[model samples]
Target: MRRPPQELWETDVLTFRKMRNLLPKYVFKSLENTIKQRTKLDVSLAPIIATAMKDWAISKGASFYAHIFYPLTNITAEKHDGFLSVESDGSAITEFTGKALVQGEPDASSFANGGIRSTFEARGYTAWDVTSPAYVLETDNGVTLYIPTVFISWTGEALDKKMPLLRSNAAMSKAATRLLKLLGHSEVATVNSSCGAEQEYFLVDEHLAQMRPDILQTGRTLFGRPAAKGQQFDDHYFGAIPERVQILTQDIEERMYRLGILLKTRHNEVAPGQFEIAPFHEEANVASDHQQMIMTILKSTAKKHGFMCLLHEKPFSGINGSGKHVNWSVSNATQGNLLDPGDNPHQNLQFLLFCGAVIRGVHKYGRLLRAVVATAGNDHRLGANEAPPAIISVYLGKQLEDVFNQIKQGEVTSSAPAGVMSWDVPTLPEFPKDPGDRNRTSPFAFTGNRFEFRAVGSNQSVSGPLVALNTILTDSLTWVADKLEADLAKGIELDTAVYAVLRQIMDLHGNVIFGGDGYSEEWQTIAVKERGLLNLTTTADALPILKEQDIQELFETTGVLTASELKSRFHAYAEQYIEVIKMEADLVISMAKTMISPAASRHLSEVSATIMNLKQIGIELEQENAERVASLTNQMMDTVKNLGNALNEHNFTTIEEHMQYCAKTLRPMMDQVRKYADDIEGEVAHDLWPLPKYQEMLFIK
Candidate 1:
């Protein structure tokens, strides 16, 4: 007997709720305390904390612990080990050591390193990141420890994502301290960059997802005919969340909250089955760690609800792709925010100078900024209507732009414009704010106190982009500090010196500031021809910019990343691009051969048999039916042959060679193969089609 849907779903929800309620509040409390205290690393504390974490996890039925780290591939890595340790008496104990808690050894040969390590040299080290708290993960068997760590090769080369991120954080802090001191803020000791990433993703039924090999392997649908309904109406944006999706969102949020991640918002996105989740901003390092953990938790929790979370940039055709909008800002130990414009910001010299520093940074390293968000998956999304284009520019709404323009013109301004807000109810509240509207099409938009980098891909690690942003800002601030100090030494008034610097920067780099449509062709022409901004359209084009002499000097001087490390990253990205394309190609061939071909062949045979039976009864087969079967069969056969041949021809060895092949040859062929298969699918009977139809997967609850 078929089980009742409500009963089964309700049971799952109840169990998940129980798990959510059982999570210890003290875990997050302890984490909060740690962040505030800046406690020294006490080696003795590891075992005790590990024991408590293990106990909590085991109580929830987790069996093993995994040291989770982020590697160079822009994805999380883990090496699981059981908690059992055998004593001399042949008894097993759940043992965890402080040494084990501090470090781990894993084979690094399989990971991409851009020639940092050879295949034979397999050793790599994972050191626990003391700043990020340890967490417990509960599974079907028992609980396990999840320690955030940084991976490095035996020769001391950084092999993972965390090292560069940590280095960038330190660099930003140092640069910010210097700037603060120069601005007469001696009380401020430390400054840190903060980030709140708004993650967008799609959810589709697991059964339907499993039926499609492209999604199963690649986390995206490599081929699908566009549905009659897409995001054209924009009805899904902020729309009411569906019941099943809401349940999944609630479950994921509860898990993240338990893990000390502050998930703040969840809502429908522009595309159907697509949603976005945002959290309150935290220090960049912590924010990146939390973002990584959130993606994992979301996928796992969604599976418990019989859905698959799609993190691919362009999961389906003709709809908005997912992006991780990185909201970035800076704060000091004493002051609240460096980016906030006070009530009378036009008169605030410090605020204007800081703003000028950012504008200068964006203008100076715009290509590097584009390079940060470059990835194989992201190429399809950027420059499209659904996302901000590859052209790097800053959007400082009308009010701020006008303020800066006035400064550049050497005009004395009295008061800046105030932003407006309406509460709708007459008696409730009303407020005036900035005199500008937001531009969703802008790649980098200043929203209130922070800059939202909208070009980041959903599947990418936030660290890379944050690292570039922080490093560039650090360089820019350092330059501004030098100029300010020189002016002050020459006996210039602070306000006058600040205005002079702002004017100089505005006059030189003001072309990067655009408060208009970034998607228009006219803007592209202006950005390139008049403004002289770079448009790096692909990972291949963008990665090389990192090797520029100026970029290398910037990183080396800031101590954010060594030139060697930067080269490794460039190589890693190039190799990863090729591997991703190859993986997709392999999946396409597998699906075409096993699922598409067989289904189409069976349908063709059945149609032929029906025609024969009708002909035996002295009635000729319908011409339309006969023609449809023949055409579809021939197309399917040709597609299969072409795709198979393309796969066989992938003989490139180096990463560069492979990338060129994929971009110039492989991807286009795959598209051609998909076209015929989709046409055949549309012609075949519904039940005979191999994969789930777009309508069913997208619209079904």
Candidate 2:
């Protein structure tokens, strides 16, 4: 039986409405101030709020609570504790104090702290993030109260994604508020960045997933030949959802709704067995937290429905990959969305200024944007035909580009209106169309009201990219505000001063805007040589941008991260890249040797036996198939040996050099080995093949 919308939606979440109803009016106001205004938390109200939260959670059938935090590994971490407190008289009573709710001590030795704290010094703190609401996570066995928190070291260094995100948001808000004031909005509200990440993923039957060692160990397949009828036919995009998958989606959406996540769209993505779910925009911090839970629920619910959710950017070869397109924007209660270009964009000075700020930010800190989304899994998706290219360029549609161009040329001109679309048929009514079409190939595209960052990988936490975007925008907005104030101080009129600043910005940073195909080879060449933009083709090329002095200064100047904290992130991400490649290299060797090579050898032996048997019967058989298998097996083993040797050659002097070796040297060697192994897969008998084929896994469901 299905439940009503009002009955099911947000029933498990302790949202602001729930809190307002549960707590006293005064306590609720104080907490709301803390959440909305970023003010200091009133300690006096914590006890009352804690008591209310406990009672509410208890009513929801929660016996335990967990302080959930996101560590550097781009995943959620939680340490659960019971509400039962033992007394000296052997009696147990449920007790949750304000202090316990506000603070938690979780051993951080095992988390990826990026050398922030030594293993011996295991002290870390989880401070409650009042901005993101707490909710009850229901599992098969029981339900637990999950409160999102920020993890930090004892020395006050930021050790988790949420801390930097919150700090970056603060920095952006301060700058945005200043800019809004400069635009003559004296009563500006607190500005915040918002995000709606469109998550793309694949699903394979759990039974088949368990049969493949590569899929079991890594989220992606190490080697598999392309399916004969893969997504090449272009039939799967927005195709009919399979019945089993539909049930899974319904279950996942119901769970998401209860957790207060507003999932807006679901459809078949370009690739077979691939799908995407997009949520409505929310505060960036809460959106990131919800994204992690969405991934968790997708996997858990898929498993219950006999499927394995694959979140890897490229889980299979020769098919479209997955990306988490982060649709980002900035807004406030006072002015509404800052990026919205209303009907007449020529007169929308506020929108133009804000849009110019983003342009300046992307132009100045494009490499930093690239570096944040760089990961081993994403390396396969970026620069491919299905995903955006490695170059970080903005795509403003024809209408907005025209307005910006007019501003650049030192004039105010008429803006293009959205035209109507109609067919000749009388029955087909006409509708208004957008001024310009969408460009899916663009890495950062301005779509309707927000910019969609299309390069983010499916498996990554949205915090890293959000932090980078907020920090860079903060820097850019601060620059814009300073310029405006300076021009105004010189007795320039407001409109003239704004146009002067925008003209200067366009002249300097306009090359980052492109409304063309980013995946084309011509654009790749022109973007670098003609436009002077970077084409960071690999993670090794991209991650080095994080360590640049300008990037370090950007973080330092904005108060988003200290010098040590930024350096630690560079180290941690570089180490992760190296480790991922190393792990994949090891898997390639193991699977090729233990699974692929043995199967090929057995088939070769059988073929040779058949040849001998036919010869005895005076009917000769050609050994072309057997010879091809034998040759491919030898080539694969030899390449695997070379890959092993390269992996063992860890005599590099710097982490940068090690990363380059992994990218330039070892990755190609692994691909070389895979080529041979995949060729063998084609030649081997289907019944004797050790691993599941791509055809079955992709099309079975």
Root-mean-square deviation of Cα positions for candidate 2 versus the true structure, in angstroms: 0.9
Residue 507 local lDDT, model 1: 89
lDDT of 2: 0.93
For candidate 2, write residues 1-701 as lDDT tens digits.
86765678889989999899999999999999998899999987888988899999988889999999998998889999998889999999888899989999999787887777788999999999999999998888888999999999999999899999999999999999999998899898889999999999999999999998888888999999999999878999999998888889999999999988998999999999999999989999999999999999999999999999999999999999999999999999999999999999889889999999999999999999999999999999998888999999999999999999999888887999899999989999999999878999999999998999999999999999999999999999999999999999999999999999999999999999999888788998899999999989899999989889999999999999999899888888999999999999999998888999999989988899999999999998988999899999998899999888988996999999999999999999999999999999999999999988999999844
Backbone clash pairs for candidate 2 read: none
List candidate 2 segments past 4 Å from native: none
Writing each residue's lDDT as its tens digit, candidate 1 over 81-166 gives 88788999999888767678778999999998888989999999998876775666666765666778999999888888788888
Q: lDDT: which candidate is best?
A: 2
Q: Show where candidate 1 strays beyond 4 Å.
A: 1-65, 81-97, 412-416, 419-429, 432-434, 601-654
